[model samples]
Target: MTPTERPAGIVVVLAFAGITASLMQTLVVPLLGDLPRLLDTSASNATWVVTATLLAGSVATTVIGRLGDLYGKRRMLLVCSVPLVAGSVVCALAGSLVTMIVGRALQGIGMGIVPLGISALRDLLPPERLGSAIALISSSLGIGGALGLPLAAVVAENSSWRALFWGAAVLSAVVALLVWLLVPPTSPGAVGKFDFVGAGILGVGLICLLLAVSKGADWGWTSGTTLGLGAAAVVVLPAWGCWELRTRYPLVDMRVTARPQVLVTNIASIALGLSMYAQALILPQLLQLPGSTGHGLDQSMLEMGLWMAPAGIVMMLLSPVGARLSDARGPKVTLVVGSLVLALGYGSSVVLLGSPWTVMLVSAVCAMGVGLAYGAMPALIMAGVPETDTAAANSFNTLMRSIGTSVSAAMVGVVLSQMTVERGGVLVPSEGAFRTGMLIGCGLALVAAAVAAAIPVRSARRTSDHGVAAAERSAASVS
Candidate 1:
C-alpha cells in the first residue's frame, strides 16, 4: 500500500495522540508530594512515576521505530496507543507504588509515537505545508512536557491526581480513534526479516545504560551495580553496532548511520538534548532553593512550572517558523541560531539567578534556539535518506536526544553534588563544574552548526521525490 493525502481530521488525531502521550511524563510531577502518601511509598520512590515512563520511553522508541520501518508505522501507531490507554487506567486505580510504576511503563508507549507521527507528516500533508507540519510534530515533546505540569497542578489542586491519568487516557483514546479514521495504510520499509537479535541487544543495552544514568547518584556511581551496568553497556552497544552491520535487516543500520551527515547529526542531537535540559534541571533547583541564599526563588513546583511554561510555549510557537527557515535558508542556520541562543540563555541564568523573571525571558530565547535546531534536524535526516527509513531514522534521532539528556542529567548530578553552598551565604556552585557542562553544550552546538553549514545546499539540492537507486546502493554496501 502507498500513502495518499490524509483527511484533516486524521492529521489532528495523530497530533493530539502524540501530544497527550508526551504529557504522561511531566504531568506526574505536580503530584510529587501527594504520591508518597497515596501510593504508600517514600518521596524518593514516588519519583519513579516519572522515571518509569522515561526508561520505557528511551528503549521502546528505537525498537518500535525499527519495527515501524520493518512493519507498518500505521499499525504500530495503533498498537502503541494501547499502552497509553491501559497505563492511564491502571494508574487511575492503582493502590500501590509497584502497580503505578507498571502503569507508568505502559504509558511510555506514547513516547515512540511522536517520532512516528512526524515521519507520517510527509504522508499526510502537501509539500507546501510539510515544513510547518513537521515542526509541530517535533516540538510536541517539549510542549507536552511544559503543559503537563501546570495542567496537572491545576487538576491535582482542584480534584485528584488520578484525574490527570484519566484525562490522558481519554485523550489517548481520541487519538486512537482519529488515527484509525485518518492515517493511510502503508507498507513497511526494507523487505526482509526483522532484526530480533539486534533489537534485543540494543534494547537491553539501553535499559541498563539508562538505569545506570538515572540512578547512578542514588546508587553510588562507583557501586558495583552501577559499574557493572556501565561495563555491560560499553560491551553491549558496540557489539550491537557490529551485529547491525552484519545483519541483513538490522533494527538500526549502523552502516547508513555512519554516514558523515547522520553521524554528525547524532553528535549535535546529544549536545542539543543536554543544552536544552540545562534549564530544566538547573532552574528548578535555583527556584526551589531557600530564598535566603539571595539567588533562590523558593518556589513551589506549581510556581516553577508556571514560570517555565513560557519557554515551552516559545519552543512550540517558534518551531514552525524555525522549520520554514530551515527549508528556505537551510537547517544549518537554524541550528547555529538555536545553540547560540542557548548559550546566551545560560549566560543569563548564571548572571541573573536572583531575578526569576529574567531567567524565564532568557530561557524562552534559548527555547527559540532549540526550536530551530530541533526542527531542522529531522528535515536534514529526511532529505539525506529515502522515505522508507524516515520514521526509524527520526526515532533514532529522538534516541540520541534522550541519551544527551540522560548524560546531562547524570553529569549535572555530579556537578550539583560537588558544588554545595556553605550553611549560610550567597549560593555559589562549583563554578568550574557547572561551566564545564555549559561549555560542552556550547561547543557541541557549534559543531552541529558546522555540520549544517556543510550540507551542500547549492549542489546537493534535491527534488521532493527522487529515485531510490542511490540509498539502496549505499545500504547494500553494509558488509
Candidate 2:
C-alpha cells in the first residue's frame, strides 16, 4: 500500500459506509403510515420520528465533520458508526414514540459519514481516482435513499417492521468493522483546540432554522412558534458567522469559504439541493394518491418504492461519468451541465407524470444530474480550500445542501397544502399543485446553473500542489 498503490477496497468500504448512513433517512418511509399505530401515539407526535432525525442529522453533520478534520477522519468515521448501530438496535426494540424518536436522533448522527468519507478520499486516494471516488461517495446520499425505499417497503410489507432496524444495525456493524480494517489511519489535522462555542452557536441556529422549516406546516406556517424560530435563526446564524470569523481555529473557516469560487459553489449547492428534493416530495405523492383523483397513480408504498429504486442505480452508474467530466472540463462546467440535466428531468415530469414507468424515467434523469452535481461540489470545494480544512469545508457544503432541502420541504409543502382537490371526502394535492412544484424545481435548477456559471476559474499558479502531495503522503504511510 505505497503512495503508488491504489486501495480500491478503501473506496468500496467508504462508499458502503456512506450508503448505509444515508439509508437511515429513507428506512422509515414505509413505516410512516403505520408509525402512529405501532407506537400508540397521535399522528402529530409520530411525525417527531422523522423530524428528530432531520434536526439531529443537520446538526451532527457539521459538528462531526469538523471533529474529523481536527481529530482524524478515520477515527470520527468509526465513532459515527457506533451511533448508527446503537440507534438501529434501539429502534428495533422501541415500542413507544419517544423511544423511536430517540433512536432516529441517534441514527441521524451517522449522517456525517458522507461528508467525512468524501474528505477521507482526498487523503486516501490517488489524484487520478479522486474525482470518481468523490462522485460515487457524494452520490451515495441519493443512492441509498432511492434504494432504501423499495427495500424497506418490501421488508415492511412482508415482515416485522423491527427487521428494518435489525438489518440496518447489522449493516452498520459491518461498515464499522470494514472501516476499522481497511481505512488507513491519518495524521491529526490542525493543531488547535476544538471550537466548542462556535459549534454550539452554529448548532443552535441550525436546529432552530430546520425545525421551523420541517415543522412549519404541522405547526401552522404563520403561528407564533414558527415565526419565533425563524426570527431566532435569522439572528443566531449571523451571530454564529461573526463568531466563526473572530475565533481562532474556527469550526469553519469563513475567510476561505468567502472566496468567490467557494462561495458561489455553495450558493449553487443550495439551489441544487432544493431542486433535488422537490422530486422526492412530489413524485411519491403522485404515485401513492388514488387514481380516481385523475392525476394520482394509486400505487402502494411498495410499488412506489420499486418505481423509484432504479433511479438510485442510475445515479450510482453516472458517478464515473461526472468524474470524467470534472477531469475534462473542470467541476464548474460539470456542475453547470448537471443543473441543466436536472431542469430537463423536472420538465420531463410535466408530461411523464401519467405513468409509474415514465415517472421512474424522470426520476432517473434527475438522479443522473444529482450524481453529476453532488460529485462536483466536493471537487469544487476541495480545490478552493487547503488540505487541513478539507473535512470542515466539505461538511459546511453538506450543511448548505441540507438547508436547501429543508427550504424545499417548506416550499412544496405550502403549495400542496393550499392547492388541493376533494376526493372521497379527503383533500388531495391537485394536479395543478404538482405541476407548479415541478416548475419551481425546474426554475431552481436553472438558477443553480447560473450561479455555477458565475464561479471564477482559478489560475494554475494559485492552485496548491503541496496539498495534493500531502494527501498522497498521508495515504502512503497508513497503507
Candidate 3:
C-alpha cells in the first residue's frame, strides 16, 4: 500500500504496545549493577529482576493470547496495557529487590501485545499490508529489547534507575489510550471452555522448570529441593501432556504439537533461545568486568549499551526481508538460513568478542538470524492450525522460545561456573564449555532449519474458515 493510503496510525499503536511491553525487560539490563547495592541484596539475587519478568511474561503470553482469541483481540490488547502500567508503577516505587521482582512479573503481562497484535492484524488490516505489519511487530521483540537497553542506560546515568520503570509505566499508559482510541473493536474470535486445568498444569510446570533453571546453580541443582522439583516435573509434565490430549479445550494442543514439524521447530526455538541468551546474559558481564580480569573490555554501561545498540536495527531491517523471502520461497527456508547465521554468530563471537567492533558485528549477524527464525515462526504456526486455534498455537510457539531461553540460562550458567581465569588473570571462558554451548545452539538452530524445511508448505494461501467469512463480507461491501 502507498504511504499516504497506509493505516499507519493503527499499526503504530500496535507497534507502540509491542515496544513498551518488550522494553520493560531490556530497560533493566543496565540497572543490574545498581540494583544489588540499592536493594541490599546480592548481585546474583538481583538477577531475579530480569528472570522474574521473563517467567511472568512467558506464562502471561500464553494465557492472554488464548483469552484474546476467545474475547476480543482489541479488548485483550487494551487489558494488557493495564499490567504494563501497574508493573511500571510498582517497579518505580520498589524499595527492595523482592518488590521489584514482583513489579517485573507484572510487566510481563505486556508480552501478550505482539502475538495478539498479529491476530488483530488479521482482522484490522488489509491483506496487502498484513505481511509487512506482521514482520514489523514480530521484530519488535528484538527492537524493543535493543532500544530499551541503551535508553535505560542513558536514563539511569543521568537520573535514578527507578525513573526508568516510571518512564515505562507512563509509556504503557499512553499506548493503552492510543490503542483504545485508534484500534477498531470487534467480536470475539473463538468460543470454548477456557482450559483452567491446562493453564494450571502448564503454569505450575513452567514455574517449577524456570525456578530450577534460575536458582539451580545457586541452590545446587542436586540438592533435595532441586531433585524433588525435578522429579515432580518429570511426572507432572507428562501427566499434563496426557491430560491436554484428552481435554476438548486444552490449554495447549499437545496432540498437534506432536507433529514433527511443530515439535522440531519448538526444539529449535529453544536452542535459539539458549544461543540468544548467551549474548544477552554473558556478553554484558564480559564487557564490564574490571581490567583486573585479564580479558575484560572495561566499558562503562552507556558505552556498552551504545555498542550493542546497532544489533536491534539490523534485526528490524532483516525482518521484512525474511518475511518476503518466506512468502516467495517459504518460511522454512528463511528459518533455516536464520539458524545457520545464528551459529555463525556464536562462532564469530569465539574469535572476535575481544574487540568492540567485532562484538557488534557478530551481534548483528545473530540479530539477522533471529529476524529470520522469529519472522518465520508465526507463518509456520498459522499454517498448521485452524483459524480458531491461531492465538493458542502462536502462544505455544512463544512459549517454546521462553522455555528455550530459560534452559539456555541454566546451561550457560553451568558453563560459566566451570570457567577458569587465564594465566594473565583474565576471566577466560572454558574453551570447551563455551564452544560446547555455542555448538549446541548452532545444532539446535540447524534442527529448527531442518524442521522448517520439512513442514509441508501449503501450495496456496491459507483460507480461514471463520475469519474468511468476514473478509468476504468486506470485499463484497467494497465491490
Model number with the top lDDT: 2
128: Cα error in model 1, Å: 2.4
Q: Which stretches of candidate 2 lie over 4 Å from their true place?
A: 1-6, 460-479
lDDT of 1: 0.74
Kindly provide the TM-score of model 3 when superposed on the true structure, using C-alpha atoms: 0.90
The digit string of per-residue lDDT tens for model 1 on 329-411 reads: 56656666777777677666555555668767866776777777777777666655566677888899999999888887878
Please list the residue runs of candidate 3 whose C-alpha ends up more than 4 Å from where it truly belongs after superposition: 1-6, 259-261, 422-440, 460-479
Clashes of each: 1, 0, 1
Using lDDT as the measure, what is the rank order of every candidate, best first? Answer: 2, 3, 1
The per-residue C-alpha lDDT of model 3 at residue 306 equals 86
Query: What range of 10 consecutive residues in model 2 has the weakest lDDT sum?
Result: 459-468
- Residue 326, candidate 1: how far off, in angstroms? 1.4
Residue pairs in collision within model 3 = 294-426
lDDT tens digits, residues 261-310, model 3? Answer: 56666766766676677766666666666666556677888888888889
Considering every candidate listed, which one attains the maximal TM-score?
A: 2
Candidate 2 lDDT, 326-374, residue by residue in tens:
7767788889999999999999987899999999999999998888999
Clashing pairs in 2: none
TM-score of 1: 0.90
